[model samples]
Target: MAKNNGDGKLHVAMLPWLAFGHLIPYLELAKLMATKGHKISFISTPKNIHRLPPIPKTLTPFINFIKIDLPKVKDLPENAESTKDLPFNKVKYLKIANDGLQKPIQDFLKTSSPNWIIYDFATYWLGSLASELGIRTAFFSVFPAVMLGFLGPPNVLIHGDPDNNDNDNTIIIKRPKWVSFETQVRPSLYQLTRWGHYNSDGENMSDVYRLGATVDGCDAVFVRSSFEFEPDWLNLVKRLYKKPVIPVGFLPSTSDTKDDDININNNDSSWLVTKQWLDKQEKGSVVYIAFGSEAKPSQYELTQLALGIELCGLPFYWVLIDQRGASDEEVIKLPIGFEERMCGRGVVCREWAPQFKILSHDSVGGLLIHSGMSSVIQGFQLGKPLVLLPFSAEQDLNATYLVEKKLACMVPRDVDGSFEPESLADSLSLVIVKEEGNMYRDKAKEMMSLFGNRDIQDQCLDELLHFLSTSIK
Candidate 1:
């Protein structure tokens, strides 16, 4: 794969995880890289490849898609459409896929090797195999600096202590004393307990450990965040990694794309209709509500949320992905007359929506969100303030990062992973009707200017191409 520099192009490969959140960023990163005249190959399972929207064939002339097969596993559902429909959560599927892709990767490397491979956390387990084949691999962490701190090697080594898993909502984690000036030592006991649940069963604990081990072996590590939001921990991570730890800002570009060509746009003509409705609203008045692809609120909580929106009496658009696996009759149990009440004021849609476009819309002033990283990035980049209702996973940490750091406001959650209506109403009132709301909106705009630059993509692409082509002396 070592072509002469006179040709003036580099070759790179991208392997994203099965989840949509992971896949979207990798696609954006690939697009950015391809803009710099690099040859790109994207590897994924066939099912996921087909799920991608069709891009302009001209824009991706140098790109190719490679599909790898996974072996049959018992008790797994057949013909699972997407990661959401998989029999197990992402962690379990990651391990199985890592083991399954080993042979295919080896064969591909022997025949046609790319200069470098960029991968996500789920595929970290393949680093050693890549190294054994004399290929360099880089790891891209898609979470905030603090969550990355909790997931990085240092935390993993000390995190297994029994006291770390206490049931209290807060845990005090002590960092190196010298770093105390810029850093405050804190551990989220609630988050740890939740992560324990996230990692339990099917050797999930071992898989996370494997993930940390893979990070340790990376040629370089790039986190998709900037130092402005996390000055202290960013410095701490640099010291910890002691390698080329680059802060490439948020890797997703918010530039307007040709959405008419996207495959996911085929369904739900209502989304476009809603866009027209949103355009008619007053600027900075409409609330954009979405709970992400995986977060399915129970009928009870869904009712409360709906009623809360009705009570707030704000113009809003909500993407309610019904994951109850219930029939239409059974789905009627949520909120009494809630749908009928918010009918004109709200536009409620099912399953999928064109989220990026919705977030970027001029009429979207605030977001009622679950704080998933992808949604968080979308909101942050779009300069939209947030009213957080974290469902599960790293969302707790993410919500805390946004609210505690003055990026967004948090709505209350219950002990059983549910939300309340009155509290949500209060949060909405504060974010929408109060002076503090304006302050948050202004801060979000400033942060957006820092992280959501169109130029960072070009810079990242340039660096990646340099790393791929220039031999380290």
Candidate 2:
């Protein structure tokens, strides 16, 4: 049998996917558990674990990071960080991850075992195996509660038909009997851009199969959201999963600032400097534009964004990631003299930036984003107004939910699937100078307050510990 820490403090293990979006939140949860006197073992591949900044020696007393070697796979991309970066599909990634988990985790359990494991979506394959070994498992879904509500019920995932074939239009909304079209649609706007995957037929089949396989034989499924946000959906999910379905809110109760000097190799430090710059600017004067790591716009959209920022005439910071159209041999080729004209007025980081710190900066009045949930949650948490530009995947749904719900404004993606300079500028103007902008900013603040104030973390921690204690006993 797996052994506990022996202090009545739950011994918790964490296993997240390779993606930054997945890794950051799970790490935050691990930090929270460690603060609650729980012993933690954060498991990841050596490449991934080494990417983390070192926690100060002071916080080292509570947590341990366990690194295991990734199995040898041929023709894998060099410097592959997460499953997202792999050349294969999500299904393929899960299969390999499941194979990888069996041996290392089994060996870990045979040695120093954890009472409970707070695992990510990709780790679902290990559920039955973990249970067989006498360790309890809980699933931590990084997506919103509503997505969980939709995906949680095995029937909806298995039996339901998508609303449309267009990845942009496949919005199959299941509202609470109490919510009206307006309120439900309102809440759905911010979610639309993020849930873009539901719009595509390809995603529907793959996601359904993957989620069903993952949720099977798991102990509990916890969503990172709140009851107030979607009480009816949460109830629906509970009925469907027939397991403990809980919403743990956005932020945890406590976070230990470990890894003070941990540097993400390709991440840029200019963002921190921008934070200082924003601190000096007038409140709400600057706009922050960032498409998450996956978005790779064609050369046309790149020019359009540049033109839009130029037309908006706002002091802005645009941190670009994974802009793949340009090769290593060719530098970023801007419109003629675009840099000279916009010099000092704009900043673009081809590398990753410190997003949370930038959003929290006082001068950052608004954000232009691809509606990734992590970015959306953080943006909302910081009370910054948003202009959503959803690409593919869940981002389209998230953006839709935020905008349709009046939490943000949508800068509709281009025909080729990008944001144009004109629409981009219009959206920016509406949010910053238009009457609608004022409303969005105010509503964003309200949402931020709700997310920040809800003691979701404490509730989650308490429930997780309870489950661990019961299982170990």
Candidate 3:
């Protein structure tokens, strides 16, 4: 059994990658630890920190937001601190800037000297830093454990494919020789190539290299997954990494606070209009569409998507972000007369929408979204079936997993990984209107037995806390 300190309090420092997908889970863990009487220092750049969800007032005292200055890079745009602020190619610059934080973070560690430092995969340097300060380090992965298992050990990932000559054909993904069971999570050759390119040669170290080092160096590893959902993969991760691989349960948003209360109190007109529109829709009739924060679709893709939604001929609420900065023309141009054709049945929101509230609404029966892990958890939590359109970075893997598990249906894409309007419409209809989708609906609801079990999740957290407490001594 693990032993807690005399006062049963531990000081922990959290460091997550700059993306919201990475940052949010780290914050959730910090909040969970805070509720257990731990003091946490959450570190990030200023702009990224400013964008985090509002921390509950009661827990504010125990959690400290520490800001580090982002180093200036020539190609990286000014004030672009997070992945959300940059286009796909420019993301490497953000990583370079993040690597520059080593000295500042090292300095902070020397002074604060926390018992344990919980970090994300990108910060491979953190393990050495924690060692120098006589503190323990734990790696908290926001991605699913199954995806990690498919990638296999770090040596295989970094050194296995050294020739780079495997680009001529589609590589079939299958169960590694080390693993016993077959996995459904497979990436196409194009997806793998893009991934390889992103993490390949860079001014600083590559992400793949960093991930290998972090896994080898950390004291323990924690993944945002559950045994009920992925027992085999969880077991394989421990065997592959040769470390304590802990599952921390899917971190769902605990805030049930209604946005209507705040909207009504503040007299916000736009939200009132949107909420009233949602109220009028028939139960389980509307499809909620959002492609996630980081995916920037081209104008042609956006136009095709609009047409596809129109062709589906269902009531839909779509959230599209405006990426054209200071331009006079619209960022996403819908097919001409689209609004006039489907005025009452469709609503488009260019600004931020309350995603949780919309997902929880009675009118929402299904989701049309990118295969983000966070979105997957939310949809599963609400028992909403998915029409998946994956864009980049582990999303294809997520889509494959959901489809194989019968929890969702994926939109068909071309050999080059591009989707057409017809295929998009067909996927939407299959999930929302066709009889074939019922199995997905049933399987998604069945997941509630595990995904909604608060007791199991609490037990997992307790085990994690115990590990943290004991690892210090």
* Best-performing candidate as measured by TM-score: 3
User: Using Cα atoms with residue i matched to residue i, what is each candidate's TM-score against the true structure?
Assistant: 0.86, 0.82, 0.92
> Which residue runs does candidate 3 get wrong by more than 4 Å?
1-5, 162-169, 172-174, 196-201, 256-270, 322-332
> Candidate 3 residues 1-473, lDDT tens each?
12244798988999999887788888888988898889999999987787777677889999999999999987878888887777666778888888889999988988887888899888888888778778888999998887788767877655564433573424335445666787667776667776666666646677767788888789999999998888888898989999999999887766642231112123335666877888999988789998877776667778878888988878999887657223213355777898888789989877667777888888887999988888888888878889988766478888888888778999887766667788888888888778987887787788776666778779889999998887785
For every candidate in turn, the CA RMSD to the true structure comes to: 3.7, 4.7, 3.4
Model 3 lDDT vs. the true structure?
Answer: 0.79
Give one digit per residue, the lDDT tens place, for model 2 in 1-473.
56666577877888877665677677777766676778889888777787775554655787888987766544344455455354223324333544566788778866776777777766546687788778878888888755565444554454444443353333554453333223333224334443433333432234555566567667888787777666656776777688887666675222334122124674555656776677677778788888765554446667887898899988887776433322222234568888789777777766556666667678888988877776777777778888877654456556655665678888865344555687888989889767857898898899776666636657766876676677674
What ranges in model 1 sit over 4 Å off?
A: 1-8, 87-98, 154-191, 203-207, 256-268, 324-333, 414-419, 471-473
Clashes of 2: 43
C-alpha local distance difference test of each model: 0.67, 0.66, 0.79
Residue 9 in candidate 1, Cα distance off native in Å: 2.3
Q: Output the worst ten-in-a-row residue range by lDDT, candidate 1.
A: 324-333
Candidate closest to the true structure, highest lDDT: 3
Q: Which pairs, if any, clash in model 3? A: none
- Best-to-worst order by lDDT is 3, 1, 2
Candidate 3 Cα RMSD (Å): 3.4
Please write out the lDDT profile of model 1 over residues 1-473, one tens digit for every residue: 32434566766778876666667667766766776667778888777777776554665787788888766554334544345554234446445644567688778766766777778766655677777766777777776666666444534543443555653334333442334443333334444555566567764445466556657777777777776667766776777666676665677544444232123535647667878888888887888888765566656777888878887878888887665222212343447677787777788877567777777778888889888877777777778888988765467767776676778898876555566678898898788667867877887788687667767655755565666566421
lDDT of model 2 at position 239: 74
